[model samples]
Target: MINQLLLRFKLLKDDKTLIIVMTLMALGLTLVFSSSMSGNYRPEVMLVDSDNTSESREFINELKLSRLLRYTETDEANAIKNIETGMSIGGLVIDQGFSDMMRNGKEINLSILRSKDSIELIQLRSDVQTTAFKFMSKFKTADMTVDIIKGEGFKVVEDELFEETYALSTYYWRYRNPFNLNSQVMDAQKDWAYNPMIHYLIGFTLFFSTFTIVFVGSDILKEKQQKTWQRKLVSPVSNTVIISSLLIVTFIVGMLQVGIIVLIGNYFLDINWGMNIGLMLIVFAAFVYAFTAIGLVVAGLAKTIEQLGAIVPIILVSSAMLGGTMWPLEIIQSKILLTLANLMPHKWAMQIISQTSAYGLNVSNFITSVLVLIAMGTVYLLIGLKLSKRHVY
Candidate 1:
């Protein structure tokens, strides 16, 4: 086994350019794509507060904390003109007497203005609507409390009581929402920070690593070409030993390439892989093993070395693009494409990484993704090993 492993390493050593190119492409494309996709540019959205009341002011303040877009104060005419002229992505408008409308139980007057519907526009609308909903609920609670006081005929200033009660209810709503009972849903929607560098960095790493693992797996065909497999069968070494050794070598070589890319991401690109190092390593391991297993199928399926070289890229890149490697699936409007993406392992891997690293999502949220990756690897490994036994070469 040791000799076989060394022999495999010797073979891989001769292909140093393959390793170097894969590593460089992973990091290089991340920088290029991220820059093209507004790596650090957060779109600015205009805010029109005609009411200029405390409620309206607080609503605008809430918008500033949103990760989706930056909110700035401006007039309705200015907001419309900029959106029309393409200077702004979108705008939110608060009609006159917005607070009175809320307190008086009249229509909730709010409007969203945009050039067209985009992901950012949708998120901005959601943020504006959600904020208004919270204020509406808080006022409802205040109104309920004040009505009860009025019925009791208490000698209290009604306006002053409503103000105090409204202020106190804000703390209650913030500290304890109905969804807090379930820990999973508590902060699920909180602070989904988007960085194109982080997105493309993880994306390209996953994309290019497939080339490394699959090419390494193709060494089985190489061994056949050099008559190494036939020579080994006549020796004391068993077939199991030969296959196991090759698997280990493939895993180690591929991991080193991935590790180098990750290091570049950390030191040079300033990417924080995630908070939990242990889990992140598991993610990397599971990803390699899954595709390494898939490579077995590739090796078994391709009848010639030329076919192996050509078929692997088409399969891998298509999977990557379908899995949201180039651009986010959120922007892809086609329902068929969205549904088909569920079949791609890269989709689950990207989902788990992006959520955990950027949003600080808990492990429980992505356990299913990890499990699916392992299951796919195991199933593919079995099929590949079986199919390789019948190879003509």
Candidate 2:
């Protein structure tokens, strides 16, 4: 095993593999960062407030606090014009006497003008309606109390009593709404703090690491094609040692490549690699083992380097695509595809990295992903070892 490891190291010492790995790391980082930090498409919403009172201003402020919508204060005429021109998706027209009606507990109406209806716009509309309702809850409660008192034949001045109760309630309702959303405009600063690039970087790293298996598998196939494997079989070196050596070398190569990329990503790219570096390393090792075992399986199947070169790319690309390397798995709406994706080691690896890198959570957050990866690797290794013992045709 030690002799094989030394031989593997000497073979990999050439600039070819290093140059390829570095080039890929550089290109992948550039594309991932650029694409992830690309401008967000915020849906424009023009606000037309006929009642420009303090209450109306408060409502507008609430809307501005949401990052979901790019809101602008404009007149009804301009808002209508923008909507017609398709410059804005929608407009919120705060009708005349909106504040007075809301204070007096009258049914309030808001004119929502949209250029075209879509699912996203519908969801935004729903969010706006819900927020408006929550904002008016205090007034609605006060109005109901006043109505109840009047119905009891009390000679209470409705306006004065309502104002007093509204004031008292305002003081009592000091706590923030539990459902209050913390939305920030997508600026460069915030983008740096919560960058999507980190996820993409981790994802692409795992995706590219699968290719190492191809190289390892090709090496095995090359030995068989050159009849070196048969020569080794006739030697005193045992079959178990040869198999163990191949597995160990492949595992080491995968780990070293992955580790190099990760270091480059963290230090050179200035990415926050979460707080749990130890757990992250463990996940990386599990993933490497999984893919390396898969490479052994490919080696067992392929007869030559040409065969490996053809077969490995297909598997790697397909697995990466399904495992959220090519795109986010979240956007894939197919239940069947999603279920199938879970079978890929890349998916579990990505999940573990995503949890640790983004959330800084403990092992509890990603133990399932780690376990899935390790178990998959163990199964693949067992099957691959069994296959590795067979003579290549």
lDDT of 2 by residue, 168-247 (tens): 65556545433467866443232325456666677777877778655764466677777888888899888888777777
How would you encode candidate 1's per-residue C-alpha lDDT over 5-61 as one tens digit per residue?
A: 888888887678888898899888888877765655778898899899987777677
TM-scores, all candidates, are 0.67, 0.66
Score each candidate by Cα lDDT: 0.80, 0.74
CA lDDT of 3 in candidate 1? 87
Best by lDDT: 1
Listing every candidate in turn, what is its Cα RMSD in Å to the true structure after a full C-alpha superposition? 6.8, 7.9
Span of 10 residues, lowest total lDDT, candidate 2:
185-194
| TM-score, prediction 1 | 0.67
